[model samples]
Target chain A: MTATVHRLRKAAPSLDPMLALVAGDMNAVNAVILDRMQSQIPLIPELAGHLIAGGGKRMRPMLTLASARLIGYTGTRHHRLAAAVEFIHTATLLHDDVVDGSDLRRGRRTANIIWGNPASVLVGDFLFSRSFELMVEDGSLKVLKILSNASAVIAEGEVNQLTAARRVDLGEDRYLDIIGAKTAALFAAACRIAAVVAERPEAEETALDAYGRNLGIAFQLVDDAIDYVSDAGTMGKDAGDDFREGKMTLPVILAHARGTPEERQFWKDAVEGRRDSDADFAHAVELVQRSRAVDDTLARARHYGQRAIDAIAGFPDGAAKAAMVEAVEFAVARAY
Target chain B: MTATVHRLRKAAPSLDPMLALVAGDMNAVNAVILDRMQSQIPLIPELAGHLIAGGGKRMRPMLTLASARLIGYTGTRHHRLAAAVEFIHTATLLHDDVVDGSDLRRGRRTANIIWGNPASVLVGDFLFSRSFELMVEDGSLKVLKILSNASAVIAEGEVNQLTAARRVDLGEDRYLDIIGAKTAALFAAACRIAAVVAERPEAEETALDAYGRNLGIAFQLVDDAIDYVSDAGTMGKDAGDDFREGKMTLPVILAHARGTPEERQFWKDAVEGRRDSDADFAHAVELVQRSRAVDDTLARARHYGQRAIDAIAGFPDGAAKAAMVEAVEFAVARAY
Candidate 1:
């Protein structure tokens, strides 16, 4: 379902290869996720399951599993650690919904909308605490340190984003810093911990971290690009949602940077919540297209995508390596 | 400033002894707190400082230090751990304010009111994550497990309390369960971790756990009683806050159980948010007084307070022991 031409295969790049590589490990991770999320308070699981069982791709945990396979670590410790990573991700999503007052995610009602913000907040806290418990059970202070630091960075990035909200002047450097912390930090930690569990050396740990970090940036750039490009519908996101919310995504940054003075004024109005009508969004699309902002955004995604693939190039060639490469390809190719 | 008579000296019970015992260590813990709450993002430290620097009693961290002192472990490790405990407590308070939609706490505007719910929610997440980071830095998996489990239990209790909100039929057993998880779990964990860090035996850990747990319950029971007995204002809590919010505390539970049919209906209306007028609260207080509900609640507090003191009876008799006993007395004596 991807559009990028593979130089060697002439076929579309897809995540199927990575999914196949980690299917068994993924099952183990899923089981741990379902098992640990249950609580004596029924609302805890009910609210959590709505999102956990919701039909989003288990992208973060899959990275953990895939990274384990790439390193040829055949132990089962990543199963629990992968589940912990997913729990952190799920907790972040639940809290994000509350913070944004988001009613829908991935074509489903958010937990906050269904269960109310208080439940969402508390259950999110539950999952977060549970994630740490799982890490402690794994008995790796190193892993605990990594994940906990990622969590703090994610919170910091969220606060940064919150404070920077609706400001058209939030240039690319600050925007990238925001996404690096909020999105890439966990992906990096998720992959890095696999190395830690495998007893891999610092070099491998750092390489895997780079791989996940770069892929995460690419993934987020595409997601942000999708918000401005209505026809990018293969991904289940509803375009213009960010526009309506006046979110300052990279495309908005690029479009504002490259626009005429009048166009920059229009962009500022849109970001500041004044212009959100369909016609306004349509004009926004026209302006971004005229300035090639979406094109450059995807170009930036591909740049990071290439870095991700190269980060793992030193690993021995095998199905795992090929799938990992194709996964980055698939990530960057989605916006096409 | 406390009313309870000490058997040994015929003097009033007070926290001054305990406060004096931990004064030096508390400064070190405070230093750690001030150092760690900083962030590159200005708003994080800005919002967190407003509450952390705001005049909180630092009771949870003080418990950690006091427990360490009682065990005669002269290490300074509890300084950082105690700060971590205080962070966990502050995070909980921030989220609690958001959950309760409370505008004031400790007679000052809450973080949610001064900033907003979004800031409070994110900063709470930051502090929670930061607390785990602190625990991880301490490099004790045992401590991590205790604090992590306590954190999860606190979230579960919060969800339980939310679901049980505005329900007059919430009996004593369920109310105890709720408070046990919400309030006592952290207290137990805070005190228990001191033993873990001191390398004390399991028996000491369990004893400290019981001491803190029972004291937490007694502390809460008296706070609930104070809500009904508005003239009991030495605790700095604005009494009758729970009544207006339709909170079903122990005082309401006992009063409803002892009320006549008409009085029960009034309580039903009060707990369900129908009866919140000043005259209604006055009549409600009169009913609770005639039923002796507040008196019995304080009696229950004394029961737990005695249990708390007895739990640590095996520890050596020293200033720490006397201070700990008087602290319990000071807690349960507040309602009188």
Candidate 2:
């Protein structure tokens, strides 16, 4: 493992009991997950397998499994829910590539680029249906309700982002709402739903939901910040890629909000007018840094991360709780 | 009213009960639907409105309300579900216009032609999200489960249709499966879910579901046949529109399956490739008639219609039951 991987692992709590639970005593849950994730069409399986194997951190699915384990779930529904979460994430990624018109994702050609937009779209639908089919096997109405609402929120967030693209008038609250809808809602749903499926007490369910929501918010904010400041090679794309694509990320919006008339004019002409060249992109990056937008963005992410940790404070200091806390800290501290 | 309208009124039963149920006694449902369906953006709302108001007979939403009532539902959730069904159908129409590159729908310009593809696609997403938001208001896990599955199936069916387009090997079973997934699944869900939410007995629910499935199959078959035989004004838009677009409707597929070598070659060239003028279209229409393909197609539709009526056989004979039977008969008998 790389140093980053080593660091993340060291920080992770050793929840042996939870791990044992997920291992299904004979690794049956893992087998079920693997068997169910396969697509009927070889190409869909291949494309999805590539993404699943591409080191996604597996934060959402892990939460689902961990939440179920923490709540003392005995049946195999958690396994199905975990697999459902992963499928939902993968489906969103397929659609996201089309919406972003992206070529590379995680240092590889996007599925849209490799398999064509129609294939990506159709396969994405297949995954979505496959998810419902899996969840139905679990026969848990709570899981269905949570996941369905999450999908709708995610789609709405995408639409809102599309409408907000290239517009510099986006404020901090709007950014929060957009990202919350797009990213955090599903993350929260993933963990919250695991608890719901396990039939946990209402208080524990509420605490876990708050923790997941805050953690997800922090994760997205950090991602936005990294998009403006991370190394192109390490990040698998250019820094300020969002700005180049005319996305009004938090840093750019903040920087523009605080810019002088001349600076604002430059942005109006460049960002909104499709000025996606190296020079224009570099200028935008410089402006964001000069304005200290990166610092403010990081601070906001840290605030959310702290709140994430705070959310789990009501629980006993067990290994699962500690691991959840550490995950939030690592999310805020990590570099791309 | 015209003779056709008068006949339709006689055949359509008293839709007032279903309409009133969908609109609710308070009348807020219609206002909400009108408000949500109205577009503030330029040209999009106009085109969408034109199609939305195109005297569509509101068949899908009516099915939802009628099924819910048949199951003894007393809640307002059915109204919201009805609205959601309409939104989904409208969204599909928007996407279908782009995929078919259609200029007119129900004798009016399609949304794609009026608002461009990008706008139509994005707004289609909007309507999709709106549908989910509407469904979410009911907070019924059963309803969410049914709708989510239906949405996924619809997307899959669209993808399958896209793949099957421009191919001559598209057989009858594949065609039926495609239409079943794309169109009938939602209708089936609309009817069955009402029974589900009302907590009816499984047998009754299954019956309503079968009624919807058979009705949808019959509805699509007759609609496809009318593309060849009906007047442009009566059917809305010009006749032979599907042929001009190279769509392989039931009549064409039937004719091709039973044709001689010369007729088969003509089918392959005209339906699969080599775009032709008005003369070629005329010749193709003549061939379809000479082969008696339309008769076979209508017979198949009637078979499904009979099954639809048979599905509701156990229900105590009442106006609603009679109306459903008459509706099926009218749907199949219209073109003839």
Candidate 3:
């Protein structure tokens, strides 16, 4: 590992503290997740369990739980809402695997690989529907509106990404917009709804939304950077997957913007799926490094990370508030 | 058409009068549909319009409208709810086409065929999320609960069907369970929600649900039987699509049960996907006919049709009630 990576590993706030703080609520959220995933069709549970039971970070639901507690929510509805958040995230992952034709997720065979694309897609739908049910049971139209709108935005982002994929000319603004819709929108909603359920004022709701939105952006930026820097084992997917899939993430877009004419042609060929050998990947990585794309990507992530911290600064100092602020830092640090 | 079909068509009450009865409300529903489908991304509206703008019977949404009118509702929330119902149905159709590898729907090329599977799946998700947004906007927790639960059940039924696909030994009860989850559940929810939004008594809600549930069962039964007896032109989808996909619809299941040893082997080969030629389809049809599977399936459908009519007998006589009764008869008559 690089010195930066070593420093990141040491300096980043451990999620263990946050997880410990919310252990009871997180436990309840997990129970709700397990209970809601059951269906009369055995395969529904079987396929869904394979994905949901896999040891994902549970970061989104953790955000919901942490945000709810940060705002002093004492009700059990946040547990259901957290579960709903996770279900929506899980559902998207299942569909994303199908869309990307991925064979593995979180170091296990993807559900699509095990059950085929049809089952994955349908099960994803089931999880999504189940998420709405949980939201309804929460009995807050404001919460429902936030999460439901986020769902639509997420789908819109996926479709927008599809349109932008393999296009060398994609701009950074468009890339940011795509990530905002696909990833940050849910995070924003997850945090905003915590305030809604707590009956917090609109200002707090907006502040929490801002915090989550910036954190989500930072998270995705780091994820994209990690793809360029990390190996298959560390990334939990094949190295250079975004490149192979023609995804126009930040590093590629930045590299393309900074490349010479021949280098630009190289990126265009790679993104259009004309270049896909190990040697080609190596050359692409070298070009990206030569253009300092990863460094630039991380800098952008840090910018968002700082904004996330700023967004939550008005909240009273507490364990939940401190962990949430640290989460933004950790999101950026993960790239190193 | 056969003589029996001709006679059935003549005796069946026309839906045109029903359609005309709620034409204004349906027009409002369509406006909501058109408005919600719009997105700045451009491809979303384009792809969704291709499917939604293509003509469909709009049966489920009509039930929402009719049921609301049946319960003497004067509010406009049902219009939004009806649009939400159509969005859910359309979303399912998009995903279903991908799952079934279907190229045609409603006598036109399917969205997946025009745009790849990824676009279709993502857009379908967009529509689903949009559906939830509409439900949330309606601001009725009961409406949200009914629709959300139906969505989950529909997905569960789809997964069940996936598990049961190509299995020659699928039982009648299992088939009923599958259809109940996938098709009838939504129908039941759509009608029940009309009562909910109208604030009708629980008994009336139960009655409307029963009416929709039986109507949906009869509708699907006729659909399955039509696949065996009708041509592609009449069926919209290619004839024998279920057989080609090795779907264990009621006809195939019953035929498998009643076949001779040799005939059973034929079904086994066909259902196991070892038979897919024109000659195989012809022979499979012959076996189904010899075993009287279509006749039996239609008989069962008629029984459900009668029950659907019986379910709504307590409603006061009116044009809406008359139209709904005709809908049940119309559902069964289509198979003839």
Candidate 4:
């Protein structure tokens, strides 16, 4: 009679190799980020720094740098573009905190919570404008096109999510579209610009884009799944936070789809903001587990992760590719 | 007994001539605006149209078009750039409404009021991103640099104003800086981009830029002055709205500076949110009038208006020049 250990991940899939692959490049991005975020208006840097200095994994920029390595490109043009990508991501996060009224991010108080919504909104605008300036400085019309279009898509997706909020009938298809625009658009743009800066062929750009887009979707789904995992080990995300906020994510969608009539009513009530207490959340975890919603969510993640790895399969099989593959695995396995 | 009209303007000083000058070009610009404001998300157009079609003067875009005419630019490139300028202006207005928590704009319910702040914010971001898409489409790095830097300056100005809010000690110099960034930066960029598209000389570009910058500062000063006028005819700006919101404008700065000790205390109380009743507002107006703060503010606007006219004096004396000069006079005289 021995206790069983249920580990969902294979060995220790980690971002360590990817971090090692681009550690020096990330430092350059950090410097660009710091230099560009500054303003004579003190509040700009103060509010922007709160989130930039907070513990984001720099995944989007890291993708840019690693993709460059995959192409065997030795140019430094990718550095500015990577910083621009990070700035775009940071702008989105700042606005998201305000739109979500979120108080905590990466285990610290959100900029909106600390600096107020107006400051957050204005600083986000500054960073966004600064991103375009950086792109223009890079002097690549193709890169500008990719990023400017991506920015518009991300904003459209944000509005899509806002309208879909608190709705019990948001199907998986629309949910996919929403996340595709809001989350994956930037990811794709970040990777695609690396190919553009490297002067690679259109095929390479499209391939890297596919890689980032698929990984972004998988990463977001696992993040959604982690919200219901009672023993979640993630640093900033507390379990049941989304449940309390009536956030519409895939696990809830799947659980509601497979639920009994009474359980369905429970989910509807919870989503509509009636049932949000600890007992209700506990019951929610139980329901999702019994229905295997979280498990299936992670399973879905792995499917996309495979697609992500395959997207870049044509590139050389070395440290860059291996680290990228492991990073995708790490994204999907974080829920464990 | 004959009535003393006491009109501040010398002649009619209407914008009709400028309107007539750019009527054809503006139609092209309006088409671009309507076409580009659209998105698959119906809400984007709906929310944006509430302001875009809701009776804005389209002053910024008109500057672009009219500047092109002044520079003898025959290409249609300025049309897209003009629409882009309007998009940036519209985006800023939408966010401004949200930041101010404004309920009404141009006498109609604000988008933020009707669609919610979240919609307004996201739509503003969408339009901002869309503006960049237009710039990228135009494929002018020079124009992109000018507009993007203007955007950053505008955001910085907004944050500066936020930090300066409710401070009676906000001096006239800082007030100029705030309005310069928030209002004049875009005007200068809008005018300068016309020169870029026209491939004009740097001297001509600088001339157009100075003209627009001076006019913008004058235009904003008049707008600020209108808020204190007992009979402000500007449809959108309500008298005492700024006073109630503790907004730090030149009128308050001057009125505070020249006040008696007791009057200074009154202003401090008003700016600090202690005095905001209807009667209190009436008293505040009286204090500013007695100090001649409103009159002095208009005088300052006239000085800038004169400079605006003089900056473009070097341009050929033609219909464009006359219209532009009249436009400046019209702006400075609007409070009448």
Candidate 5:
């Protein structure tokens, strides 16, 4: 192993087993996701297939498989669970693009832009329903409960974020709460369910859930941080896109708090009003950088990344745990 | 009993027993719906509440309660189930308004009009998730399976509708399939679930499902028929509005098939193009009326209504069963 992997393995040995299982079956999980997303409606299936095949990191599904492996599951149910996770995530993305009026997603034209908001929203709902159907096949009420709750929390968080936009008072705590609901809740549920389906001990299940939640927080924090610094190609979105949209990400929240009076006033006006020009975006980015918001936000992400590693302290030594630790570190550590 | 209570009791003896359990308690269900629907965002909750209280017939929930009673259910779970059904229906309406870009609904401004599409879409997601959460609380994996599957089918049907828009060739078979998924599937599932929850005989469960399915189909057919004939207040919307939107209701479809070459081309350009003005709408309505499309469509609806009554043939003669039968007949009996 490379020095980075070696260090991660030494720090969190439990990740090794999970990584082995995930790497071994990544292709199979992808196949399952594709197969189940197909609809009897010819146009729907074709459109959904094209969107699903478009490159995505598939990070949420990885959590499901990894958690199951960590809990010593040998059944194929994890594969179904992984696919379900992907479907739910994809459904949310389709709806999100429509709601956000976004033309681009993951460095490509969004489904809503191609088909129309009506198609995307309805198809997104289709995926959500289909995901539940997949979970039902497992016959686990606990799994359904976890997922259903997570789905509700995710929706609530998105609504919260909508209200949070352009508000000067959005703080770190609310930010964490928003990200937890919007992003981490599903990740946590994805991992927790992996353990639950395997019938692991409650302690281990809780540990895996914590790990997932912390990892998700780290992922989103870094995402927000990168929104200020990275280009469209690297970040899979335009730079300062959130600023233009008046979204109150962690970096912007921090920057606003630490800015001078004039800077704060600029942010308030910029966020509340539409900022469509390059100069407007550049101004937001400059102010964020000047206030050290990016650095502070990166520090917060690293903190959560470390918390993720700490959450899995009790798992047995393995490659899965190690990779998970490495992945969390990589998420926030990279400049991009 | 008061006259209304006596009338209800006379019509549906089985429903009398169930109403004894649920009538006074429906407020709790409504409260649950309202509480769960509240968002941190002012616009979302404000608009959602207005629409939720917008004089809906609330047939889905009543069907849920009646079905559970028919199956001898004694548990409080039916209330939760009823609320979930209503939430799902409401969520769909919210999204549908946005999809149709409708300014008016039920003779009032639509949620999308008052709150904007973003809030409507996101809040719709909120209600969808809330419905799932309620289903989870029922602790029946079987119920979750039924509800989620129905939800997915509903969404798929919507996507199919979106793609089929403005297509003059959308036939009866395809229309039936779409409505089955979009409308009847949930109605069928709602009844089926009551049987499942009450642990009724398999045959009885099947019968209840058939009853709901036929009833729902009839209900939709009547709704479509009324679109061409009923006035705004009586039908709860303007007359012949479907023509303005280019929606091919059953009457329109029947008339189109029976129209002369000139009439066919007129409909093809006007309704399908969604470019119909008052004159065009008047002409189309007049043509449909003269072609006997309204009568023909009503005959089709009555056929399903009869089938709905037939599906309940096995049930013992009781007030509830009779009322249920009346409900089906009433669905298509008159415009109101």
Candidate 6:
């Protein structure tokens, strides 16, 4: 346990500095989130509160806040926008839990489990609508266009993932495209909006967008890797959930690609046939480890993480920029 | 069959005149809808097409088109906004079917039944995001605000209905609030967007909103009444679906209000206790008939229908206005 703690410490710098830097803004964002989530319909607040109150790290919203600060945005619009970003994220999580038939989130029972799929889906719709309301209130057409487009793209990605589920032939480029649309589009939108509100130049906007897009790809790649390497206690979900659910994440795709004919047959059985017993999971993990698929996935994540750092190279050196860079590293290093 | 056809013919004036007036714009809206519903993910279009092609009366989009024509506005933006309205309604229907666990819609299998709940939820989300994309493309903040707020209210109403499900104590006022949010909010927003895009006076906007809101309430009241009075062949869903699902629609609420001790007990058993069977549905239908709940519900519907006419009475009499008035009558008379 001590060694594990020490290794974790050496894994990467904490997000503490970034969190601290934007703590004041984050508090305001939280207030908006709490206030906007309220509804006269009791079940809405009750169901939404269960998920929001479970308190996952507000990583996406932090990116919005951090990017805004990095771009030297001085107005209060970013707070509302940050809250909007969190609402969008939370809304997707609710619907994703329903779509994934997930049992646990953040080590707690998912809202869908407690309230049923209907409530989760409806509350998710409510949160999504509320996010748009916030965006409308922000009163920026450019921002609205960016965020709304990102939302559409996110849905497309989810559908693409659905189509790709359980297919052994799922390619790496398609996997990246799925993550790019589902995860990075929002990250790009969230950061780009800071530039929009800051009234920054197009180049700055593009830079921040690239930074967010790459960071988001890295974040998801590392997340897929962590599923293979981490335990349920650390990952907040059972290991090999993707395998059981027949999800085609990066490591699974890579491992399948590099595996022997026998190993390939094993994946087809475990994933496509859904023969995911404990033994199957154990064997799958061993195969993935042997193929160095986890290492390859992390390497890809680091590649994107570095691009994220490069995307913001044009920005002047500042505490916010430093923190943002550390955040990219932190996202990648989580797999270690 | 002949007698039923005669009754349906006498029950309502057709929406054909209104549909005819806006046929060109409606065609354009359909084109946009077909165009926008497409995604690289084949499953999305495939699933959305199954539902969209099943062909419910495009009444909501017609409302937007007719409302725009009523105000003598000449713009193509209404076509897109109307499409957006239909998309919102369709998205809600997809989600609602999932929430209701419905098996049939429009005399066909439901999307959830065909594609599974996960696909339905995600595709519903895709449609919703697409709706927002349309709204943003229309590029009106007022329209965005109205539609987005309506979306939020719609979800809230769905949650309220969930909470009120199987509860015999739900009052009429709460019932009105629920339908107002779930059904009428979109109608109101749809009609109001016509005025918004036309840059009409505040009075015109308010008047259109009232017309749509009251019309929506009337429409729902008649729909609930039809569930008891009409057969599955006509209603495109099994009769007594509301009763079977323990939904607190007006007819059920009214029947409960007017029932004797024994009948009330029967409702409690069939609805709240989830003991509904074919016999229970038959008995419930009989009790509703005896209590005149269907008639009373239609009377309430007519009252709102009349108010919808009155709300638009200030407008000069014209073909557009006449068609709008006929729509209200058609909504109420559907219960006949």
Cα deviation of A317 in candidate 4 (Å)?
Answer: 1.0
lDDT by residue (tens digit), candidate 3, B1-336: 222111123485778767977899999999999999999999999999999988888889999999987878999999999999999999999999999999889789999999999999999999999999998888899889999999999999999999888888889999999998889998998899999988889999999999899989988988888778745344466678778877788998889899899888888888899988888888888877889998899889988888877787777778888788777777887766
lDDT of 6 by residue, A1-336 (tens): 121111112355767879998999999999999999999887887888888878677877888899988988888998998888888888899999999889988788999999999999999999999999999999998998998889889989988988888888889999999999999999999889999999999999999999999999999998888878745344466677777777788888889899999998888877686677878888888989999999999999988988898889878777998888888878888756
- Runs off by more than 4 Å, candidate 5: A1-21, A230-232, B1-22, B38-45, B230-232
Clashing residue pairs for model 4: none
Mark the 10 consecutive residues where model 2 chain A has the least summed lDDT.
A1-10
Question: Per-residue error at A127 for model 4, in Å?
Answer: 0.6
Question: What is candidate 5's lDDT per residue for A142-259, written digit by digit as tens?
Answer: 8888888888788888878777777867888998998999999988998898888888889888998999999899889888888788553545777777777888888888888889
Tens-place lDDT per residue, model 1, B1-336, is 443433322257789999999999999999999999999999988999989988887989989999999999899888999999999999999999999999987778998998899999999999999999999889999999999999999999999999999989899999999999999999999899999999999999999999999999999998899988878667667778889999999889988999889999999999889999999989988988998999999889888998888889888878998898989988888776
TM-scores of the models, in the order given? 0.97, 0.83, 0.95, 0.97, 0.93, 0.96
Interface RMSD of every predicted model, in angstroms: 0.5, 4.1, 0.5, 0.5, 1.4, 0.7
Q: Rank by DockQ, highest first.
A: 1, 3, 4, 6, 5, 2
In candidate 3, what are the lDDT values of residues A1-336, reduced to their tens digit?
Answer: 222111122475766667877899989999999999998789988999999889888888888889988988899889999999999999999999999898978779999999999999999999999999998888889888999999999999999999998999999999999999999999998888889889899999999999889989989998888877745344465668777776788999999999999999999998899988788888888987889998999999988888888888777777887778667766787656
Q: What is candidate 4's lDDT per residue for A181-282, written digit by digit as tens?
A: 999999898888888988899999999999999999999999999999988756478999999999999999999999999999998999999999999999
User: Which TM-score value belongs to model 6?
Assistant: 0.96
* Model 2 CAPRI quality: acceptable
lDDT of 1 at B196: 95
- lDDT tens readout by residue for model 1, A1-336: 443333323257899999999999889999999999999899998999999999878999999999999999999999999999999999999999999999989889899989999999999999999999899899999999999999999999999999999999999999999999999999999999999999999999999999999999999999999888878666677989999899999999999999999999999999899999999999999988889999999999989988888788778778998898899988888877
Q: Candidate 5 on B221-255: residue-level lDDT in tens?
A: 88888877846355577876777888967787788
- Of 1 and 2, the candidate ahead on TM-score is 1
DockQ of 3: 0.82
lDDT of 4 at A194: 88
Model 3 steric clash pairs = B5-B336
lDDT of 2 by residue, B1-336 (tens): 222111122343444544554444225445556776654333435555766777776777778777766666777677777777787788778767766667888877777686665455555655665666676666666776777778777877777777777776688888898888888888888788778778889998889889888889888888888877745354575767878778877888888888998888888887776756788888877887888888878888888888888887777665566566666777777666
DockQ per candidate: 0.87, 0.26, 0.82, 0.78, 0.66, 0.77
